[model samples]
Target: MSAATNRGGAAIGRISDLNPVEAGAVLYLRLWSDGAPGRAEMARDFAIALGADGGRSALAILDQIFGLCALHGRRPLIRHGSGCVCLGADENCFAQMIAAAAEGEHDDALMMALLIVRPDLAPALVALSEQFGLMLRRMAGRCAAPAVVH
Candidate 1:
């Protein structure tokens, strides 16, 4: 689902440009896990949804991940900070995420990004992402996964 679908709306391409620390954190956390084969798309969608709060920089990073995976068939590196993880997407720079860690929890990657970029948004973003992911899964008729997370 698109981020637009997750919430009611957003500012369209008005996200903040990432500072180096924020960029590094976003990329590292996203690429920190072993994502499912089709996960990057979810990562992108989730990021877009979260972008409603996080802005364009988040969208930029997630879009990059989506482009890398959806187009290049490359897995996003979700553990590159430790081993180059990109959430089943490409390894390009600039990234984003927030909210979702199995119910009432913050997704680690999203948490990391929020901490680096917008710490105030961490809590809300996680809750929204989790709720949105659950809603999307149900609407799509898939079994609910553990989280709206990567």
Candidate 2:
């Protein structure tokens, strides 16, 4: 079965769908947006991994994405609470779309953009989403250190 498929041979449709990189992105975004108690620590870790400037820029892009979603009444269905780590289908979709957009898939980029913004603004959102996706990828790569056996 492909990484995108589940045990039942159906397409994975939720953030619980764990491909390591996408899982990391989903966790980061969830903590970043859901008022979780871990938010500050995760942000600090992200900053450490990407440096202050890159972290700030990446976070700004996230803010813009969320802002546009709200502005356009298409807010992503994120299911997180103060300490919950559960994943949502919408969050998975966003992570996948952002990753594809960052990979220069123009159709995915445009479709993702159109999900939250007007056509005139889709181009700009696509660029921002691409940047955000790249940052997420970098964070996942840098932070996935091998575990030490005791």
Candidate 3:
């Protein structure tokens, strides 16, 4: 995916840009929501990427994020269906918010918390999103690695 560089030359892009981590996160969410084909394989890959402890932690964080959303009566904005290859604007915004929050951007974190109508939960949400994002990055790295056969 092509990315625009910031003043510091760090690449920045929307989720539609499909950076590996964002792509993996979107794929994971899609598989999770659909409970369809490739779910098991993707889960296995995620587990392998994070190892046992990290896998468990990531699962817990994900559960908490979902639970919070449920409790707040807010559904996450996922625009694309399971079969679709295109990422929609809502999905891009959602992923971008999470990425910014994970990076400790207070305005983004506040915006997300407000979007969920849970300003009280901002810190918790930010922390969870940060951990989840890190896990996704690790998974992306593992997926990108070339296989070595002895």
What root-mean-square deviation over C-alphas does model 3 reach?
Answer: 8.4
Per-residue C-alpha lDDT of model 1 across residues 90-112, encoded as one tens digit per residue: 22212333223323345564643
Better of 1 and 2 by lDDT: 2
Every model's TM-score: 0.26, 0.70, 0.70
Model 1 residue 55 distance off true place after TM-score fit, in angstroms:
21
Q: Over 4 Å off in model 3, which ranges?
A: 1-16, 36-42, 145-150
The whole-model lDDT of each prediction reads: 0.37, 0.66, 0.62
Candidate 2, 1-150: lDDT as tens digits: 343333222234544556665676566666766555556766686689789888777777877876776676344344444344455555556666677776889687687667556777777777877888788778777767888999
Evaluate model 1: give its lDDT.
Answer: 0.37
Candidate number with greatest lDDT: 2
Clashes of each: 32, 0, 0
lDDT of 3 by residue, 45-128 (tens): 657888878876776776786567557624444445656767754455546556666566758756755665466876676777
Q: What lDDT, from 0 to 1, does candidate 3 have? A: 0.62
- Candidate 3: TM-score? 0.70
Candidate 1 TM-score versus the reference: 0.26
